[model samples]
Target: MGIFDALNTSVGGLQAQSFALQNISGNIANASTVGYKGIGTSFEDLVPAAAATNRQNSAGVTAHSQATITTKGTVSRSSVSTNMAIVGDGFFNVQKPVGITDNIPVFNGVTNYTRRGDFQLNANGNLVNGAGYYLLGVTVDPKTGNPTGNVPKVLQFQNNFIPAQATTSINYAANLPTKPATVASTTATAGGLKAYGGLDPSDFSAGFNPLVIGTPAPPFTDATTSGSTVNNKQATQISGATLLSGAASTDSIITNFAAGDTITVNGTPITFVASGAVGNQLNVTDSVSTMLAKIDSITGATTASSVTNGIITLHTGTASNLTISSSNATAFAALGFASPTTQARGGGGTVGAGVVIGNDIKVFTNESISGGAVTAYDATGTPVNLQLRWAKVDSSSLGSPHVDTWNLFYQANSSATGTQTAWINAGTNFRFSASGALTSPSGSSISLPGVTVDGQSLGTQTFNFGSGGLTQYASTGGTATINNIFQNGYAAGQLQSIAVNNSGLVVGTFSNGQNLNLAAVSLSHFNGTNYLKALDGGAYAATDESGVAIAGATGTINGSALEGSNTDIADEFTKLIVTQQAYSANTKVITTANSMVQDLLNVLR
Candidate 1:
């Protein structure tokens, strides 16, 4: 072996220690850098060919650099929305642009991978990381929200307006009271009966009086509060001592009668006989009152005959179907009686008491019922107010027609004919089951067609109240509660901000309270991470050793945050101390080797 062999080996040691120190300095410098992978220097020793003597001096040491790319770093938090981190083995696909301006990244074809994720938006609205690398992702269709292609591109957030959406469907959920409020009280008379109470089951909205028919006659009772009382036939009457007293013993005789004379009261005949008859036709004198007693003797006639001062009324026998007619209409009129018309009780036929039929809709005021309102949008994105009122119909008592029917009325300010606080017929009625759940208006969906809003048309909007949408259980606190109300319509919205999710989804939020997916972040994985070439700013490039990068092989993508540097500062410092000492020791060895070589040179001289 040459005497200077030791010197050469020490020189190699010095160079190796210097290389390790450089790695330590780099690690320490980047301790706080985001997504930085620390470098560790590995040392290898070379030996000269073995001699037959079995001992040979060592050759110089060789140092190589390896990136701790596979090692995971502690996850720390960041405020930037575009920031992300990797939890396992993978790298973010990024493009390092050739240049940048106003925070905008200039894209270069060169693709790189990184553990760094401190990304921010640039002037061109491109997402760029702290390393000046543009974030790469798949472009997404604004209309479909799906990936446009497998080819990745630099992510850019553009300042654009979101187009308006027309209302297609509306979802509605609310609790309609099973029992509605009552209408106002009103009074009227029918069939000579005084009537007053509710128009519906709870309150009366309109008043009706049978006095409307004409002067109520005798035997016609007062119209009761609800037209539930009996109504009888009637006629105007007059009775006193002079008209009733007759020629014989207080018997009536107002006019002399002939044998052929006849008066038919309610289809029954009163035939007058000649003067020979005794006690016939109630003294046969034809007095106004005494002769009337003879007429009451007919069937189905309730005669209140006192032979004096008793108004002829309430002729009831088997039945009181009273109608007075004769061959000559003048004959009944001549008896001090107007033409007797067949009588019909109120609410029976043409009596004309207002009552709806066959679930017909009717308008009612909120003063007599509860109401609600909702804000709806139109084609032009204008808001319209729709007001609704609930009016109870039918009865509160239980049976067939158990009285749970209701009428819902609505009015909008955008109505073509103009709006009124007074409810307008909505063309439908809501009926409820006895258990208080809605039964009619199947599906509980209502449609408002041809509605106008802010002078624009808003087509038909179907409001799905769903099954069991309404109820009438008694409760003290009521809020007109709306479980949910949403429409598929919106005005144009300005882009507000962007966000990323762990699934690598890029979302854009707008001012109109809508969020949309804009793009998708892609990741790359290598079969041999250590074989990847290290690039500037904690990045890597593909090499033959790294193999083909598999796209979409990602660890968890943390958003609005950054991944911390893997380098431990204290550990780097320790390495620095060891490297510094080793370097010094290597230098000392070189000097000692030189001295020994010089000694050999002197001995040879």
Candidate 2:
């Protein structure tokens, strides 16, 4: 070989060794970097021309090329809820802010893809990297748990809240006890019968005439006069004709005996008798008065008696007067009077006669009373108890017939006292005012319109959380605003589970009694993932030949685990010795070529 040829060969060897050293340096630099792939060098042959019978060319050693970078890196897990790594072929998409004027782009926008999983929220409340670069993915509806679209969504805390109120109206029933009867006088009779006092002079003098004697007739001789009693000693015989004679009887005289005469008749003591014939009659003065004397002893009446000439008078207790009238002689006979001269009739008929009966008896029916008021009772006549429940709704969800949000406020029981008052403020929280006039905070207020309770719809309700902070939404076109007053009102929550799908959807579960779509992580895959350029800190960037990142997940490229570097110390040392030997051999070739050139010069000398 010519000296120049030998020199070129040695230079090629120097270049190849230098290239291998550079690759080794790179590998050592990224030995600890996550997802780091080491690089290696390759050598190619150079061609030279030689003339012969049939001219042909031969190949010789040429320069080295740093060709492929093997992606033989180890995968270690941090086990963090947010920590993620692509095991196979994909990359996590990220977007670094271009400037102050540009907002973070979404998935479809200009985004840089990486494999680094370290993520956190930035000061602007966006989930980002430590460099403040925003992530990209498909956003989802919080309530429906479904994808909205491929857009970048920021995760944040929710703060729209208010209070609720109660209800009114009540009913009842009951029974009442019956009343007893009362008694007044013991003297009151059962069937009513009374006694009369006939001895009363007032009774006799009321309307009767006085008794008198009649004139004597012929065939009768007078035996005595008013002042003298002697006669001619002749006994005059009085005949029936004298007794029957109208003129002698016209005076109604009981003349058989004179005044002050006495006789025992019908077991009663009498004093006068007629004087003309054998059938002489007696005239009893005030005969009814005498009968009244006997009745007075049996009843509660007072009696008195007086005598004048041939007449005796009697008086009774003050009531009405009794009179004996001549027209009532027949009635006198009905009273067991034998002679008109013995008994007399009265005008007032009788004294102290009618009756009186039954006293003090109860008269109406019973009625029911309850709850300090009157109300209709049940079939068994018992008072009934009542119960009530009150709840609020989301105004927007009301017209939809499906209740998305509801909060219960008050419930009525038997221990409840008075009227339940519900305060519905236009832009404040709900307040419940009880019968005792006490007010208290209630449950969460619903912002949705057209909410209903027990099938009754409420158009919309206004409520407030704190001072001057209000939420007003109607079933119509009302706007709901949650102010800073309620910003501090948050229900407690915690991280539960995490899940990811091929679409790069990230769902986080919470211990706050809810399952929420917390966030969606960015993801991408390259057509030539093997050719992707690795940067520091376990990250990768796309290049022209990496072929426009077709976004995908880990398993898409196949379930192949990335094996760690085969850069064993022994193997690298042996390779280093081999490269040094080749370098030394190339230098020897140059030395030998110089020696040959020296020999040629000696020959020319």
Candidate 3:
């Protein structure tokens, strides 16, 4: 080969070696960079001129492009909850705010995708990355877990409406007693008052005093018959009429001499046996005493007769006036007989006063009265009397019970104080009428507004009976899958195992007792992936030159475990040595050519 050709070849070799050295430096520098892939270099030969027009000739050394990088790398487990790494082929989808002219770049919006999984939560309670970009997915209702395509909702607080503790009231009902009646009769005798006939006789076994009429004389002898009627022996027949007119008449005997007539003479009571022997009356010795007893009996009869207008008047028909020698005048006073201050009969005519008696119903002045007039006085002394038109039965007001709907003052929080800003029923069942009222149906759940969490405000959202009805997502065959994505981020987890199904979903097992979908790692089988353009950071942006990425599983790429780095370190070192040797050989060739030319000039001289 020509010395010029050798020099050119050595220079090309030095350039290729330089390129390989650059790749090795990069690999060493980023050896610990997460998800970092290493690079490799390749070379080709340059063809020389052909001997003939169609003759083939051997090529000299030249370097080709160093465009591609080895994307294979080992993914070590991280200790962060949100740190995730893609195992197979796909990228994690993230959303970032672009300039106003940008249409919020999406995965399908001509923006690049990534596999880095570090994330955080923003002020709006949305999970985001360090760039303040939201994570993208089908928005899920936390309660329902249904796919709300493109619309995103976030969770930021907990439940706060718990019923407060309070006290309860009680009510009661019971009974009371009644009143008694009054007495009427006036013909009661003095002894009759002591007898108490309606009461059992055993009640009066205690001895009682008999009513007295007049003073008795010693040796109270019975009166005898004076005239004798003849037939064979001078028989004297004293007639009843004559006996009645004599001392027997003043004997204090019960008049009419009828059965059941109780009478007292000289403080002793003797019942008259039926008209004994047509006038067999016991004779009293003292005619004055006998006359006094008779007059006293007549006085009792007259008193009984004079009991008109509830009063009794006493009068005497005998020459000797009747006198009461007993000092028990208070007993007579109890009988309503007292000396009158007016007319003089004995000393003065006595009159009796009647007793005021009945049920004695009392009317209270402050009692609650039905249909009463209420007199009210104003501050200006204006007397206003209102008449209550309705009655209260069983303590319940029967008229239209006046009610005013007023706000209940309360404090919602330590800083907030105001009346409840809603209309509330003023009485009874607060929210229902006696008739049919709208009710929250059974098994229904209601949600209130969301509260602040971690110093960020989250708005209200709710989930109720939807078209799928009240069903538990875990039990139902719905899209509500188990997702343990916490509000913060995915915590540190080791890749316990990896799984791939026919649907191209790459599910990863974690050491933290969870199974997560690392990514829907899609695979595209091209005529060749070797021909695809290489973008840095282990990504490949699609171009029209390469057909659309065919979604597939890892097995479609004809490998289970990934390929390690294609970097040939030994070959690179050998190439470096070869390049050094060739450069030295090329310099020697240039020197030899210069020396031969010098020798030719010497020979020519």
Candidate 4:
């Protein structure tokens, strides 16, 4: 009975070793397979129960397959953009077709998971791995580029026509030099006062050109008052302690202002009250600075009236005109102003009359500096080159009331002759403070309304200078330093190529030079990965032991790469030698057991 038990146990051992050999052979064969999780043989021993304690007999041994599903495999670079690899624990949600209908694969609606990521786009635009498993993903909205649904389905991308989008805003950032170099800049070799078809510098300086050779009469000086006169130089101070009231001995003017004496500026009267309340009235005992404030307030001048080196300067800015007339002629003359003096505002004209006729193109070319250029699209996908230029309209160097100001221009027509409009002004007075920061429009954006470039209308668009996007700093070269400039709209485009990004989103590049996210790759993870029932092609199906797949796996997807099979040929070969040795040892046990039985039979004979 003992020898018989030995034979039966040895037989069971042979069967278990055979099972292990099969597993080792399979692992060695599939060592080159992609994303393959190798199977290992697990042996369990069986023992027979005895009537007394410590008297048990070995019955048999059985082998069961062990899954290395949770083990990681080596990842290698792939040339195919659609190919992907998981660096950790997760599987790609996929579907297998049970049949074909009209050339299209019909799925059984059962979702499967796989680690094989050798996916390539098929003729139907669906992603399929080498094993014919279709990849699934969440659809992305073209406009928002966000996932549309929580559940994932088979993803398909087609080359459909995209509608044209008109540009609404241009993000622009640049550093404007304190002094931009233009053809007409005094520093440039071709320097001459240029603007609006050679509009004379005298026009900007109120009929006086400082750049001229000869010593010209200062425009701020009246006919009777010369610059050489007392307290009339460019640097003379007329404010502070200097009084304009006749009651004060230190009077600023030859004829001091008396009570009831009024100075009317731009149709608003500033009355010199003896001692007064603060409603637009200057006290007779107040300083000349008080009188200057009243004048500046009435004219709405951005550059206020100031006296430098006793010389008084009045500016109209670009918003309004400057006009000063006094009820008392002597008092007005004492303030160094001729009765009824007037100065037109710089860069102020008809609001929408932005165009300069062909006659003024030469003037514009010489005066304006290139602001920058960009290509924009219309509603019909037509391209329009938006060329920008900056023209210095007014300068603080001209005197008080004239701040550094600029106007933007664009090319309207290249071939306009005679009276045909060739250029258009943006109709904004870009005023800069002493520190070169924008002070007008009170915001980061300005509108270029009704912009038509070379007969192509590009509707209204906003030019945004993000907070601190535009600056005016000292430049090594007297040119505009553009940091960034681009538009948001693009022409119609067709899908050209698609690739997975590190974020696991499928991005598609279009023929029109736009890249958009098309879909999001779905990653499903299982609680008990080894409990999953292995299927063909490195895929796995959920069993009762393995919990349902959970969405949003923690593993990262590497694009343009793939995972190799986990099976190692060297390790499987070592296992193979051990299994063969174990089988031989079991066969020896049966042979020895047979010898014992044969010896007993011989003795009985």
Candidate 5:
């Protein structure tokens, strides 16, 4: 009975060793498999019951497969963009198709988890691994890039045109030079940069006003007749009292007016008569005071009409531009004016007209610096180049109340000609303090309403410059230094391709060069991974021993890469040698037990 017991125990030891060998063989076979978790054998010893605890005999040994689920595998780079790899302890949620229905894979509604991430887009645009399991993920809102729901499902992407989105706001940032090097700058060279066709500071109303910054006043003409002194009289005594008739000895006469000479004030004529003239008519013998009154009455001048020391001065008085011409050049010369003179009133500037025509292009170029340019999209997804320029209006160097002020402009038409609207003012005076910080614009954004570029209207949009995005620092180049400028809109484009990103999100690259988030790859974890039911192709199923799959996992996914098998060939081979030796040793024990049984049989005979 003891020999029989030993024989049975040796047979059990052989069976256990065979089980261990089987596990070692499987590990060696799957050494090159992707995302394979190696299995090891755990031996358990069986003890036979005896009368006394100290007299217990060894029954046999049993082997159980041990799961190496927590062990990580080596990750290597792959050429496929959609391929993903897990670097930690989580598995990708996937599903296997039960059958094909109408050429589509029908899911069995059972969720499975796997680490084999050799996924590629199938015919139906679903992500499937080599083992035919479809990948599952949560949908994401393309605009917000946020997950739509917490539940993970099979993801399918279609190659359809996305609707066009109009631009609402632009994320912009840039710096402005304190001393802008404009064409009208005083430091400009004369050889190639002459002021002839360049913008002059006088083109701007605020820049030309003497009261605002002093000096550089408008051209005022006060003509004197060659010499101010007349008829050998004292210099201060000569004025409107000077006579036009050269024959009068007591009257102050410089240049004599003839009887047929005519002077025109704003196209209204005043004729010289031999004698007894009235109503837009001046007598040859009339005094300078009489002629002045007739001229003022014809021109409707309320102010700036005077004669000082034989000099005639006239002003348009803010009502209209003054145009004075004369049929008789000599008579106009005597009147202390050029033959044809036109002078615009104060407060008139082309830059304030909100539209810069082709005739004013040279002036605009000379006054403004290139701000930047960006291609923006409209509601129809029409792309337009939004070109901008900055014109420095006021400077802090001009003292208090005159900080560094600038006006923004955009090109309305590229080919605009004379009197055609080419540029439009943004209508806000951006002011900066002496410390180069924005002072007037209290917020981070500004409105550009009805922004039309080159005949295309982009409607209204906001330029969002985050806090401290704009600065007015000193630069040696004296140009606007653009730090950053971008828009939130894009043209309608077809879905070109999709790829998994490092953030575990599936991004779709459109034909219009925009990459948008489409879905978030979901990872699942289990408390008892080793207790999971092993499925085909490195997949696992939930069981009573293994807890339910949790949604959030600490593992990270890598794009364009894959995880290798965790099985080591060298280690498996070493275990194989040990298993062979144990199996042979068990067989020897069985043979010795058989020999002992033979000897006992011989004694009984």
Candidate 6:
């Protein structure tokens, strides 16, 4: 052994302590750094292979620098949504620009993983962390909301408008009153108000129900005829009369009639009953003629009625003193009477149709089942309000419940491309089950054929009324009420915001009410993370000792949060004290060794 072996040993100790102190400094310096892995130093004794044969037993000490990569940092809340932390062992795949190649961000195809998660959208709309590395992940298909492939790439968000999607399906859920609204039996036909089955004199609107306009095999005549059979174009007697807007029922006067209904003509009470009676109490099924007779039987009223082309016209002998009012709330509407309107009395005859009428006919809209209205979008992203009205074509009394039918009519602006107000038949029968549920023509979904709203031709749209979505239940006032409705269509939209989910998905939300999966964050797991090579930023490169990077998403992602440095300030300070004391002891050992060497020289002299 050399006489200065003690000095060499002490020098080695000094170097080892210095290296440990360096690690302590680094650990303490990065305590607040996000996703920072603390570095630790290990000491080892250096012994030559021939140390047992050599005189010198101990050689020196050396430092082994290693990263505490396996240690998990404290995950804390963050204001940024893109900031994310992994609870288990994993690294975020990131790409850094090594240089520009052909004006592209060249990375030399080097794959790097990082723990730093201070990610933000850069000027180019790329997610770049604080370390100037772009985050990479797998892309996804918007239509299916599924990941396209496992291949990784830098995620870029474009600010262009999200293309408009035409409405393909509509989900409608509703509860329909089993019966129509209640009506009165003894209703006095007043002026302005028209009867439920009355014909319209002025018909400016097109798109009336085909059944109403087509010729009835047997020409429909008086008020007893079904209103659904009367069309303005019909060559029959009602050919000139505009079809009434409402469902056809036995009460042609009113679909639903209740007892105790009465009519007051110039202050005369004409109540209804179930049997033969006059002035005392009228029969519930009494016709307009019976009502006029009963009124004539009274001294206060002198009533006259004419039923032509399905319209019931009524007037009093003394028009000046005649005022027909309902004793019940529904009686007036049942009689189809309103404020006295100036019915332009045509001289003695009617129009070319020869339909007898005390006064000219009126124009009216048809009755509808009212499936409710919804805003539909066109191919070009134009929006329009579509009004739907459904009217009963076949009633349960005609045949089996399953055979009962209804017609759907849609109205929008006919003049404007996106605006339609004229009703057009949907050309589909809404059939029902014996139980009163919409069962056929397929209960699963109703396919409305091609129809133009505004000027845009929207393709066939499917309506999923839900399982048993339509139901018919009897009530005093049977009214159609839509409970729920939704459509899968949207207009053009711009990027609104971005969010990260626990599944490590970077989702971008658009103003058009769409949350699209833009990319999935990539996680790489390593077997020997400590052996990974450190890079300029807070990233690590793969090494043979580290093993191949395993694509891992098993780690729980804490979004809107960051992982604090694993370095503990208190622990680092303790290590710093220990390192400082050890350094001092090494210096003292060197000084004492020097003194001993001097004494030996003195003894030799």
Which model scores highest in TM-score? Answer: 5
**Cα distance off (Å), candidate 4, residue 574:** 2.4
State the displacement of the C-alpha of residue 228, model 2, in Å, after optimal TM-score superposition.
92
Candidate with the greatest lDDT versus the true structure? 5
Residues 1-605 of candidate 4: C-alpha lDDT, one tens digit per residue: 99999999999999999999988988888888888899999999997889976787668899999999999889999999999999998999999999888988898889999999999999888999999999999988765787899899999987755678888889998887766666666533333334211223332323222121232322331111211233412245644667775433444455767778888877888888778638779887787677777766776655666666666677664445667789998776666667888776554223234456676666666666788999999889898898887777666655588677677777878788877767777777677788988777578998888888888888999989877787777787877888998997789899999999888889898899988888999999999989999999999999888899999788999999999999988898899999999999999999999999999999988
Candidate 1 per-residue lDDT over residues 477-511, each given as its tens digit: 42234566676677668888988887788888888
Estimate, for each residue in 1-605, the C-alpha lDDT of model 3 and write its tens digit. 45456556655666665666666666556555444445556667677777786875544565544533224455544443444444565543444544433433333343333333443434443445443434443322222234444432221211211111111110111110000010211222323211211111111111210001121111111111111121121122222322221232332222122333323323334333334322212232212223224434643423221222223333442222333221232322322333211111221111211100111111100111112222222223232332211100111011234111111111112221122111111111111112212122232322324322222222231212222222211212211122111111122345454443333333445554445544333233333334445444434454566554444324322112222333445655665566567656656665776676677679977
Q: What shift in Å separates residue 497 of candidate 4 from its native position after superposition?
A: 2.5
Cα displacement (angstroms), candidate 5, residue 87, comes to: 2.1
- Model 2 earns a TM-score of 0.39
**After best superposition, candidate 5 residue 515: deviation in angstroms?**
1.2
List lDDT for all candidates, in order.
0.61, 0.37, 0.31, 0.78, 0.78, 0.64
Model 2: per-residue Cα lDDT at residue 81: 42
Cα misplacement distance, residue 23 of candidate 6 (Å): 1.2
In candidate 2, how many Å is residue 459 off?
A: 15
- Residue 330 displacement (Å), model 1: 15
RMSD value for candidate 1: 10.0
> Best to worst by TM-score, what's the order?
5, 4, 1, 6, 2, 3
Candidate 5 overall lDDT versus native = 0.78
Off by over 4 Å in 4: 187-359, 392-450
Give model 3's TM-score versus the native structure. 0.32
TM-score of each: 0.64, 0.39, 0.32, 0.70, 0.81, 0.61
Give residue 501's lDDT in candidate 1 (0 to 100): 80
RMSD to truth, every model:
10.0, 33.4, 30.8, 13.5, 6.3, 15.8
